[model samples]
Target chain A: MEITIAHLYPELLNLYGDKGNIATLKWRMEQRGINVTVKEYALEDEIDFDGTDILFIGGGSEKAVRMAANRLCEIKKKFEAYADNDGVVLAVCEGFHLIGTYYKLNGEKIKCAGIIDIFAEYTPDRLIGDVLLQSSAIGSTVVGFENHCGRVEIGCYKPLGKVLYGYGNTDSAQYEGVVHQNIVGTHLHGPLLPKNPKLADYIISRALKKKYGSVTLSEIDDTLELQAHKYMADRYKNCVRKKNDDDI
Target chain B: MTKIRNSLAIVACKLLILAGRLMGKKGSSAPGSIAMKISPGVLRSLASQIKGDIIAVCGTNGKTTTNNMIDSLFSSAGKTVICNNYGANMLPGVACAFISRASITGKLNADCAALECDEASLRHIVKHVTPTKIVVTNLFRDQMDRYGEIESTAALLNEAFEKVPEAMLILNADDPLCAQFGKGRNAVYYGVSEDTGLHGEEAKDGRFCPKCGGELEYEYHHYSQLGKYKCIGCGFERPNPNYSATRVDISDGLKFVLSYKGSQHKLELNYRGFYNIYNIIASFAVYETAGGTIEEAKKVFDDYKPQLGRMETYKVGGKNVILNLAKNPAGFNQAIETVCADKKAKDILIVINDKPSDSTDISWMWDVEFEKLKSANLGRLVVSGLRKYDLGLRFKLCGFEGVVIEDISREALEGIISGNGEVCYILANYTALFETQKILKTMEDK
Candidate 1:
């Protein structure tokens, strides 16, 4: 089945090489010999979302996010329906905020998709720095950077991960990201999939399972990708230990 | 009583800054932060009460150097000047300088104040200072995480300048993006002549005009977006610069003849690269417009040196390491060009951290001309940082063979320095530069 990646505002949401998320998925899926046709839909584009399997959105500034909200509100129902039927969805950073229940910016409340229980509010201080995440579902500690002024509430429902370094939820151990079934939302950015290859393959495997049911070769690809991620993780762990020991 | 009180306040401010520095909060605006905490409206009131001219220097690159040069020029001309030479360009930093210099009654000490303002902080500070002059060096896509785009920033600057009442605007004529801001204002333009053979091609995407959305025509690019350009639709050509570097010969560090007001004199700069030449011309123009004597300008230009870790040379682990800041693709590409121009094989260590300040988005690496790194004399490339392996992948994609990756930034510097003695070029972003410098300093003590 073809993957339809609906990038909310590829131009605006792509401040942090966030477009690399979609590019990484396309290349890796093609590597697994899947017949993948990716369609990129942006704001105000008249396109049917009926056949879209996977949707992708990334990050942007507060002003850009509000501007995108006003535009995406036009097609909010279409996006909610796509995710409600278990269609794969990946929203990151500002897009993650845009897909939430409500986003408060500049003392104004803006409506979002509201499919998830996540609520985001802008703060005086900007959460801008490197972030490490420990996720139970992915079974690995992932690292990336977070640059935003808004604080997100994961609603005590479920979190994709918890922050290891930078601020995320602030209430409980810096909880990070949101994952509900086939839908995954997080702040892990840029070549986001390259750093989390297992997560990429996992999303692909789930989509395949939902569509084709119990594929063997896809599982094999998932294992290989997991090994690659584990190798990098081990190297990172070794480096951290050496650094802490002042060996450098 | 007033003198004693002013001196006490200054001492307190200095002590706070010193403590902040010792606590590893370098560039932390301690004085301003403290003053604001103590008395909020004092800084704005003091700035409004100042007698001398207020010049705000701002841009992505060269703001520190340009501010330093202009400050030095003003001081050399027998005028007391106050400036933040430590690259603290935020609101609090700007306030810190003014606060420390102010009298007990909140009156300023210096005859003039030249501040290096960050582009993002321009709107907030401009609301207070009401500057007499504004100098724009150049515009490039730096700090995507903070400032959105070239146009978004330019719009903010345009709005800020609207508040100032008839200020002398010093602009870089070569930069089409910055030059557009000089429109409908009392402006003076300064740019490098295409005489320097070092004038190379710009990054293709960053060269467009911020206004009109039309393809910008360029006579020649000094580096990145700073070049002679004109819009096709509106005939916005490079304005006949009030001050221009007529004969720029950059073969041996930057040396150029600056001509203004029917007089031409040879100007020598200690800094290298085409970018530095633009910086020199900008300083000369602003100084001359602000009533600087020729002798004072020469003395300041000759005496000034590069800031810390920006083309700063040092000895580390029995080898010579040149530490330079290369935050963006344009800057990194130019710095690599400067290193390659030395015509000697050099060992290099490059740190690429995807920190929020260093741009978590590393896609701009694809735009950098890694092909220019194929100089014959370059020996080893030790890539390290948070995204060291990713950078190594990019280098390999650019056909770099035998790249060693050490994901940890601390070891990467030591690993590269531990190698055989060779001329080394160390390139790092904002945070990594400090770490690299600290590591090299520690190595020296041993």
Candidate 2:
């Protein structure tokens, strides 16, 4: 009857309206007559994995990322075990980089949670634009914005989807995100959920099924959501958008 | 060769401006880029010829308004001033403004130049012209894909200011990201020392101390990261501003008491929105700093009509249509506050364009505290522009029902204006501003 969501580093790792994901999840669940409890964990606070349904970690500044990553390094095993069970974790942009092994900063490696087989390094050529991703995990096209200077390396792991347009995980990888067990990671941050209701529902259903086994979430009116997603996705069909200096 | 290139660039730029004017284009940037392509050192050479001071206004919000205010204050004093007007605040626009004011012989005779400098382009711009006074309005997270992050913008600003060490910085002391630049530098600060209690939950990009990365503590916030704040770890705090505004009031227009040089001056303006208070006070600070008296600044500000889209008013179909440009969350949140302050029944039409100038990523739309708008005093809520559906979806998520999506902006305007004699407030992003303004103007007073 009730779902508890944990937002890790809500204040520090807040960027690009990534907190909208939690808001979207909360609003959707509350509309279904289900009670929702949101647990927020700041820098020095302890995280409770037991009975927590969904976990969200957003992007932050380089310093915040370094500081948060170092703080969470000690308890990374708890995160791995949490995911190994049916607990859902959603990480975006710098959060996606946080679950990785290490973040290379100017030839110096800063250790992260190291729960996933992913690594990221700083790049001068920043990948930034409105991106469209065809995600098989949610069985729909995901549309959002990707702005990052870190080119990720997903070593020997299946990606969430192939990049339909814009830069993805790596230029050669042509992939967008990492999907392992109940963990979902992506850099598409239009906050990555309000526009793509199916994916938001997907993350919710997984959490619900884990708690109240084989539960089906009722359908809400998503015409506006799908309209927003398809509008941005269809714009990228024949065109690859890049930021041009002269365009400004 | 330098003289010849200057002559060619100047004449060609003038010819292009004339042609653009003939074609009904309010051209500002394109001709400047063409001139820069011809003469690379044009901005520096022209800027050096200014008889008075070259003041550059840089920040996320209030750049255009502050720069324009400075322009009006100096020009009203009968000084030959050259400014990049109409929100053209990049390197090329600065070049074009100088070229527009240049003589046919490729020499300038301006007494002063008020240039609005874009934050990301400041480093490259400083390579050309060193401003005599640099006014940083405030820092905010704008165009995430373009600026990358707020910290990167602070770094870019630092790199530029380092190049022009002699240029005195007029900073917003209340902003932790901005005031950090004044440390150990020949700079003065200006801010609203009194808490106006007007606050929004927009992205506070300056939450951490720029000095030591320690989390900052706030006594109260006037708005997004701007107010009385101090770092917990480092002793760095909001410096007592050399010029500050206190006793703020925005109930009807703006009224505040300005404090500077150990004297208190009462200041009032016919402007809405709490954010414009910063623009007015910052302009007054710059005006006084550049050797102008307070009386002249106040005289000009009292009679000042805001530049297009800064609460511009039009009457169509017997409805007052107010058009303002709200690009980012902080700006949008303030605009929403203005609308919510009005007790009169009003219909709100939001046009969100995803043009590259608007930074194709419209994700920031969700960041605007749209829920603050009281549904009680609201009429039909319509969404338009290229990214209308996206904003509409954001509304849908907020549990708003009966949302209208009219792609054609003109009809949206007409639709809102025709309804039940409600005051219509048309808000648009970058590219949609001009179009909405033009359509509103055509539909006005027929």
Candidate 3:
């Protein structure tokens, strides 16, 4: 199988080791003998997104996000077309925030790709720490870290998962992420995929299923991967239990 | 009223420090934490009583080493100086340092103080004590969860120096972020004067012009964004450093000639890693600017030994065992470069913790060039700590097999020293560093 993944703003949005997602994709596919072409599209770089099988966008600081938003405005139409064609994408943190209708910055609305109906607003209270999610799409717990200053709000769409622990969309919301067609957007970036091999495979399968009309993902030994995911998840769970017990 | 409050705060801080020591806890910051609570003016009043210059060292990396080196220069001159211990560089710790050293009469007898202040906390510290010289080592993306970005941290440091305009600023000209601070200020810049042909670090945080936000063109990088740089759009270029290290030879131990004041002085040091040269040069710049002569600095550099895991070496099983702290991506990259230089197979143990001191965010491990260590012939890979699985997964992604896992520091140390290798290298983060170091110390003692 062959997959072509296009990364947007690889330089500006290269915060929190988000590039690990692309590396994890390439690593997982190469293990299955799947050929993957990774192309980076930085600012002022022009390329048609029609043929791109999967799109990966990472998070960044507020300054980087604004720079990306300015450059991405020129390519909004091209991105909308890609989203319209049910292109597979995995966006995290501010990248996911930019996938929405608009993201608020210091009360000013900075328009994003406008592919999805979701939007995000900057919050004074940052949602940070280990996050545990019961993701319905994957039928398993998705564990990662969230260190974002903004809270996302999915407008009339099915979210990616429920917040089992830690702050999700907002401090009180149960939803952790939102899914739009083949695109998955979340704030989980403990690089998001290295520890969660299942999600890595899910994104890879989504890309293959979109391009080849069928998915054939060979299983690899995920013993260590699950161990890593459970390690953080269990720690988070115990802390939550401790907090609840203290309240009593 | 203020005098009584200050005296009470110091006496209370001293009693707590004694109590903390008796309880088997080195509570370095707790008394400072309590002192700040009792009297907010405790730091300000005590620092005012200092008889000499106070130099505040600010940077993402090398602050501890640089500040300690300055401490060495002061002691070499037989002068009393105050300093916060390693890992206690925050505002509370700065208060504790002054509180512990102050007379019960609320007066400080120290002649000088070289404080390693956290970049984010420098603004707060300056509001208390106006440093005579502000030493900015270099800025890089460290503990992003704390400051959000390097620019934000730089802005905090900028605000810090603005509060004390009379202070002579010591800046790193090689770093664009540090160099940018020199603009419209009383500042002296220090940088390396050669292109070592080495792409020092993989991650470049200072690739853009701080003034114009344009792409920066580098003539040569000493490592990770530290180099000779010129803005492509705006004509902002690297300023001529007041203190420059010419002919830096790091093939073996560090050798460099300091060029400043229209004269050159040669100095050599027994140290590993390219960044140590910057740390020492920064310390020398402060020590000299504070009134120490070149002869004094040269003497201090001759046999200067950095403690608390600045490539601290121990002999174990008749083989060399080196320990160092790798706190951030850039720091880990430099530490890895030093480790990869050895040709013989070595046991490499990496311990990672997610404490607040350790940044709690281990995502930056992906930025460290662990892949370079893959080319390094290794006898064993031992991973341990609170976030051992995260570190293990990172090394696993680098395509290494049979990673020995040990969560306990003692077991991890034993696993490495007992392995089939000619040497052992233990690299850990802030919280895990001393634990592994103490364990290795006991093992060596036995």
Instruction: Say which prediction, candidate 1 or candidate 3, comes out ahead on TM-score.
Output: 3
- For each candidate in the order shown, give its overall lDDT on alpha carbons: 0.71, 0.85, 0.84
* Model 1 chain B: lowest-lDDT 10 consecutive positions: B201-210
* C-alpha lDDT (0 to 100) for residue B97 of candidate 3: 85
**How many clashes in each candidate?**
2, 0, 1
Q: In model 2, which regions exceed 4 Å deviation?
A: A241-248
Interface RMSD of each: 7.5, 2.1, 5.0
TM-score of each: 0.71, 0.97, 0.96
lDDT of 3 at B142: 85
Q: Name the best candidate (by DockQ).
A: 2
- How would you encode candidate 2's per-residue C-alpha lDDT over B23-58 as one tens digit per residue? 997777889889888988777888889999888999
| Real interface contacts reproduced by model 2, as a fraction | 0.64
| lDDT, candidate 3, A49-140, per-residue tens | 87698898888877777778777777888888888888988999889898887889787999888888888999765667778888888888
- Model 1 whole-model lDDT (C-alpha atoms): 0.71
Give the C-alpha miss distance for residue A204 in model 3, angstroms. Answer: 1.2
DockQ of each: 0.12, 0.64, 0.43
Window of ten residues with lowest summed lDDT in model 3 chain B: B196-205
Model 2 chain B: worst 10 consecutive residues (lDDT sum): B407-416
- Clash pairs for candidate 1: B174-B227, B345-B377
